[model samples]
Target: MQFIINGETVEVAADIRTSLLDLLRNYLGFTGTKKGCDQGACGACTVLVDGERINSCLALAVQYQHRNITTVEGLARNGSLHPLQQAFIDHDGFQCGYCTPGQLCSAIGMASEIERNIPSVVTKDLSATSVMLDETEFRERMSGNLCRCGAYNGIVEAISEATVPAAAAKTAGRASP
Candidate 1:
């Protein structure tokens, strides 16, 4: 089957039943997307499928044919880190680093959700004038991605920092690592 992953189109000679996670790590050699529980419960295999976060382990490779897939590796450009990646680093959002890839990818998608005005379960008012990025909201949105090392505080902080408005970010200055 053919897949567009990280902006590259490639054909893989694998079984039709192969999971996208296996296709990426086993066939395509993109190990950044981890395999934690091998089930959809763990968000370690999260990836952006058409700009929406999905558990790759639960998706069949054949299902993603011609779909745009963004792995954690795709977030960088020209050797510079994406703001979220830099925020992860600056805020120490990782411990063992096994789950960092999924966390980063999910955070990217989470920011998109906020920008699109998608409300989570914790959203108090769907018709609220603005979306507020608070600790409660961050925790509710990121609950799927587990960090066994318990670096959730840092992860929340990183997402908070990365999601700041561009104008605010420009004036606030980058956080120190």
Candidate 2:
């Protein structure tokens, strides 16, 4: 299969049944995308495909031949960490850190999703003048991710208050870590 991963085009030998998580960790040595439960039950395998989040453990690598795949490693550019990564760190969004990568990718995508006016099922007014981020939306959209360390307060705060937005950034900054 041919796909662009982390901005590089690479050809990988994969069958239709090989999950993207396996191809990344076992075949391509990209272990950042975790294999929690291997059943898509957890969001540990979250990765960005065409700028949208996906659970790679449930997706076949061959199915992504035409997709732009971004693992946790791709979140950074040149040498600096992505703003989301830094935000996660500054907000103490993780504990054990096993789920940090997935949480980061999912948070980045979640922010973009909200910015694009994508309405979550919890949205009370789908046609509201503006889409607002709320706890219900966050919970519904990110329900797949499970943090055993129970750092959800920080995790949600970091994502909800990404530094790019001054208002939200202030929220996270003023929030207790």
Tens-place lDDT per residue, model 1, 63-171, is 9999999999999999999998999999999999999999999888877777776888997778864556565676777889998999988887787778545412322
Per-residue lDDT tens digits for candidate 2, residues 109-168, read 776676676777887778864455556666887888999999998887677667325323
Would you estimate the TM-scores of all the predictions? Answer: 0.89, 0.88
- Cα misplacement distance, residue 16 of candidate 1 (Å): 1.4
Predicted structure with the largest lDDT when compared to the true one: 1
Find the 10 residues in a row with the least total lDDT in model 1: 167-176
Q: In candidate 2, how many Å is residue 92 off?
A: 1.6
Give all candidates' CA lDDT scores.
0.84, 0.80
Error of 2 at 113 (Å): 1.2
Give model 1's TM-score versus the native structure: 0.89
Candidate 1's displacement at residue 161, Å, is 0.9
Off by over 4 Å in 1: 164-177
